[model samples]
Target: MRAERRSGSLMAAPYAAFLLIFAAYPILFALVLVFLKWDLVTTPVFAGADNMRMLATDTRFWRAVANTFVFLSIHLPLQVASALMLALALNRPLAFRSFWRAAFFLPVVISGAVVAILWSNLYATDVGLINGVLVRIGLRPVPWLTDPSTAMPAIAAMVTWKNVGFYVIIYLAGLQYIPRSCKEAIEIEGASTWQRFRFLTLPLLLPQTILVVTLSTINGFQLFIEPYVMTGGGPLRRTYSIVLYLYTNAFAYQKMGYAATIGVALALIIGSVVFIQRRVIGNAEAL
Candidate 1:
């Protein structure tokens, strides 16, 4: 047993070292930087809690947080509904099953920047595909990326489309584990399709649903690449996100200390939000 333990430790040492170097070290350094003002070229100076004070009154930062909430409002439900529906369809035996699955998940494996750029063109006003169809039908072309009201929603829709495949895979895995006996019993009871789904399928998949919500919420909070590529957080900053603001402070504005503060604050906020979500989802006794 001792020899086996030694061998296991040896096998795990590389991963432990990797995490210490890549994850643990960076996080610890960022926490230290939160109290020190230092541009990459300057000697670090202790700033104490100045960064935290500035963050408290930072209206722009609060706006970015609000913008993220708006994005989540749209992205979360759309992601869950679309992914669940697609997964249900895919679970059934269908023609070209592998092809359909591949097509859905293709965007998940593709570069996010590439997906953002592609959607940018598609959402373009004048010659873009959707607007062009609307124009042909005598409707005015909508400024999707350039309008404050539409910009975040457009990005939300794009993100949902891009990631729906990943969540669909999650739901699919959950579907596979549902006992065949439960399905057979539901059919024996002559439950209608929707009733069976509501009473049996959805309730049984509660764990997967909770997982989908928590993951998408985290992804929503970490939104950066899509808005950066598509709108540059423009159209009156409607698409500005928390992570975008953090990136701007660190790289664009050269406020490393404040950026670290934002990073720390973001971590806390994510933990709090995810905790509340799990509580709410956990208390769902039915439906």
Candidate 2:
């Protein structure tokens, strides 16, 4: 048994070392860097609480936070609704179901950068596919990525399109666990479709809904690629994101301490929001 234990430890050593190097080191270094100023070209100097103070007072950082909230407002609902609807459709008996599922999931496999770049052209005002369709349908072309009013919403729509397939698979898995006997019994009682779904299906799917909410919330907070590639924080900084702000601080401004501070703040914010969401949803599920 001691020899077996020794072998097991030896086998796990590489993965443990990998985590220490990649994950633990970076995290600890980031925490330490939050209190020090380093411009990469110069020696690190102690900044004490200055980075934290600046982060708290930074208007651009706060604006990016607000922008994320705006994005979540649009993205969360669209993601849930479209994914649920698609899952429901796919749940029913259909021909070519596997093909359909694969088609929906195809976009999820594509790189976010690629998706953003592809959508940029699709959202172009003058010569875009979406605008061409709108014009053909006797509608005025809308500035999707360029206008302050429409930029975030357009990105939200694109994000929804990209990730809906993944959530659909989640909902579909949850749907399977729902007992058919309950569905049949509800139908026998003359429960209409909506009634059955509201009382039975929805209740059983609570766990999945909670997962969707939590994940979508985190994804919403970590939003960088879409805004970075499609909008570049855009027309009036309408689509600015916290991660992008962090990247700007670290790379563009060379303010490592401030960037690390922003990173710490972002981590805290994500944790707090997800905690609140889980508490709310877990309580709801209990009730």
Off by over 4 Å in 2: none
Q: Candidate 2: give the clashing pairs.
A: none
lDDT per residue for candidate 2 within 1-287, as digits (tens), equals: 99999999999999999999999999999999999999999999999999999988899999999999999999998999899889999999999999999999999999999999999999999999999999999999998888899999999999999999999999999999999898999999999999988999889998999989889999889999998888789889999999999999999999998999999999999999999989988999878
lDDT of 1 by residue, 15-110 (tens): 999999999999999999999998888899999999999999999999999999999999999999999999999999999999999999999999
TM-scores of the candidates in the order shown: 0.97, 0.98
The lDDT of each candidate is: 0.95, 0.94
Stretches of candidate 1 above 4 Å error? 1-3
State in Å the error of residue 129, model 2: 1.1
Against the true structure, candidate 1 has what lDDT? 0.95
